[model samples]
Target: MSEKPVRLAVCVVTYQEPFAHSAVCKSLAGLPQELLAHLSVVSVCNAAHGTIADDPVIEEHQAGALSYREVLRSDNRGLAGGYNAGLQIALDEAPDAALFLNADGWVEAWYLTWLLDGLRRQPDREAFVPTLISGARCVSPFRKRGIALNFYIIGWLCLRDGPFLRQLRFPDEFWLDGIDYWLSVKMAEAGLRIERTERCIAHNLSVSDQFGTLPGWRYRNILVSERRFLRWQKRPFREILVVHVRALARCLRYRRFDLAQVVAKEFAVALHE
Candidate 1:
């Protein structure tokens, strides 16, 4: 009789950057063949200009590969929607665990091992997030003490057997920002523990050339997302306004009027309405 394989799934969402896609493929290629044997990866390409049906880099990786699935989206569904789409496919595979990896990020050889060990050891933990490092330094907000980070950039490693999975579903309403925060909050609300591993995963923080550089819209979306999170958390409007005002004051005091002006304007409007 053959032993049952320990099933695992990796989910990734991608845009139009071929280089980022290549980087992700390279990172996956670095994993051990034995580990790869029990794993499946689902990649979703969310490009507005039509999906990439095939890429030479991914084809090279898939050449003789034992475990993987690639899904190309015909239309761009934004980040949150793309991830959810990938997650749904991953869950359908009925893997013991599912990990979300960014196409722009790279993982160390033992990254999956560490995550799996964490989940195995702590049977109660619903999800585990690895520490995000840029080159040799940890760049994640969780790196610092007392820092209230609102996002999980390294993506999430979720255990399938936990009640958290059944209790929580990603909100499709959020266009981008605050999705991770809302998920984490929902997991906590369900009494499922969320843990962070000390292992560092490398994340490439490069902006896409094709996306064109526009900081204004990005900042505006962030403010709108924060407001949505505050409302979801059931925070009073007055309290949310006060928090934004304080953030603006701090930014101004630090001589960051560029950021202060943005927060102040958004908060002023949100407060009034």
Candidate 2:
């Protein structure tokens, strides 16, 4: 008898760009056929008032192998909402694990195997984040902290457990920013373990260039989310104050007065809430 291949769902959320859709689909095509056989991709395209033709790259990939679903949203629902929509689909489908990948990100052939292997080692773990490599540099991995927030610095290819992530919902109030941070923190608070994998997943996007001219409302949403997380974690008032002070300094340094004011207003709202 043959061993059953692990069932996996690859969730990719998209907005506006057809090229991103193509890139993601192409990357999936690069995976081995045997592994692809056990995978199902769920793509949520948040076009939100526009219609786009089926991505040719996706079509081409599907022709060769793998099963997928493309969800087209009539209106622009932000990242958290889009992801939540995908999560719901995954739950309905009932895969062994759901892998969330950005539409613009490309994965190596062994990406699923590597991530799944790590996940299998820790039966208690609910979520796993890959070692992110943007260009040539490795992004910072999650550090474990004691009551004093002690950080553990591990090897470049080390995997560490942090928090659990299951049936976790992103706060609807925030449109963007701080979603990832808040999710991680909340998972920790829920006592669910999150692990960082040893393999590096390449991210081609540039962080600085992406948020160049984001509007004030979006920044306000971020501040609101951060405050919500702080409250959820039951952080000390002194610690919260310190975090805000640092945030204010960064805002001033960047001359983001609009964001600064929005954050200030959000602080008042947070206090009352």
Candidate 3:
């Protein structure tokens, strides 16, 4: 006559970082036994040309309290593909929620517990996310300045409810960039709520050093993704222009002339289309 606990699937998509994945598994394994009993760990290995097959820690922890599953792929399908592959398997189990965990990061056990409680408190919400930590920085760009949107999220512990999965899926065109932004927009368009937790926080390996040296291909992808997203949203040319103009100014301020030029060209294309 007791109420059943909600089932959760923690889907982690990893490429070649076995050590990071192991650390993540270790962190999950350390969760409270009662909490672990209601969750499953799904690790998607997206290694293209590596001999490594399985993660022992994930397998070993499977027997104890938490259930674990791994989806092995021989080709690199990028982030969306990898996550979708694992998501399909997780979806088959019909869990109450699925948390997309970054392989390069780990979450505090208490944070996840808090997130689950928040989800229960807000049943109307389609998704819940924990505040993120990387070194000394908080992932919320506007949090420190007291300006935060209701739907600002970045793929860490993105706990999507059953209704969310029934309505939306990750786009196929998305490879490595813009999927998260696209999803946030899609959810907002659908009038679905995505709440951010206050006490819960996930830690990620900081990549602040690479921001300044991002390659041209990445910039090009950003431009294309922004255009595609705006067009999909049916945004007006003037609105797109305002967005690009601000982006152009930011690029120029950062001395990224190459990206500034790309943004200018994209703005023209958006104007015409």
Per-model lDDT: 0.62, 0.59, 0.65
Taking all chains together, the TM-score of candidate 3 against the true structure is 0.73
lDDT by residue for model 2 over 35-55, one digit each (tens)? Answer: 787677777777733565543
**Can you write out model 1's per-residue Cα lDDT over 179-246, one digit (the tens) per residue?**
66676555545655667777666664432221133365665666777778777767767667765776
Model 1 ranges with Cα > 4 A deviation: 1-3, 18-22, 51-67, 119-122, 133-156, 166-168, 202-214, 242-265
lDDT per residue, candidate 3, 177-205, as tens digits?
Answer: 66766666666667766676675364542
Worst 10 residues of 1 by lDDT: 205-214
Query: What TM-score, computed on C-alpha atoms, does each candidate reach?
Result: 0.74, 0.70, 0.73
Comparing 2 and 3 on TM-score, the stronger one: 3
Residue-level error in angstroms, candidate 3, position 142: 7.1
Model number with the top TM-score: 1
Backbone clash count for every predicted candidate, in the order shown: 0, 7, 0
Alpha carbon deviation, residue 75, candidate 3 (Å) = 3.0
Pitting candidate 1 against candidate 2, the one with the higher TM-score is 1
lDDT of 2: 0.59
Clashing pairs in 2: 48-75, 48-76, 163-192, 163-193, 163-194, 164-192, 164-193
Error of 1 at 75 (Å): 2.9
